[model samples]
Target: MIRRISAALLALGLATAAFAQAAWTDAEVRKVDAKTGKITLKHGEIKNLDMPPMTMVFTAKDKALLEGVKAGDHVQFAADKDAAGEYVLTAIQQKK
Candidate 1:
């Protein structure tokens, strides 16, 4: 019974997280920490973040997310919220 309950709770959590209504804005890469897999950024407009204008450091999932992007380059992407409630770069594009 306990195992079943845990499984149900986990499923519910995953579903709720999958539909999260989060957003992102166009940002430029400031610097990347290869060791930590994090990137410092200068963001233009992150509507959902509601943060003040400044550079910020964020965790990156892998080195591939940094491909085709560089410091001072403009890019657009949205963060993805996983079942564990962690946000990561899920979509990205060079500003056109």
Candidate 2:
């Protein structure tokens, strides 16, 4: 019983760690191309992607992700590599 409880606690901790790994990253929108579903960002470190701060363009996972976002907006976002190994914006929101 004690071993089972310990295992459950360990699993819970691992789950929390995984969730934290997907935390939002800070960025400033440099450009937005709604027609192409792509946006350029000058961003801080993207921890999940193991990337350093840089300005680059990324395709949004969905064109709707570009809605209400515009160039020069300060934002927080999350990105992940797609099947083709290209970074795709998964989520984004303008900073308040």
Worst 10 residues of 1 by lDDT: 45-54
Residue-wise lDDT of candidate 1 within 1-96, one digit each (tens)?
A: 999999999999998786464464778878866566667777765655455556677666666777666778787766545667765666566878
Best lDDT goes to which candidate?
A: 2
Error of 2 at 57 (Å): 0.3
Q: What is the TM-score of each candidate against the true structure?
A: 0.56, 0.78
RMSD of each: 6.0, 3.6
lDDT of 2 at 71: 90
Enumerate residue pairs that collide in model 1.
Answer: none
- Each prediction's whole-model lDDT (CA): 0.69, 0.94
Runs of candidate 2 with Cα error greater than 4 angstroms are 1-21
* lDDT, model 2: 0.94
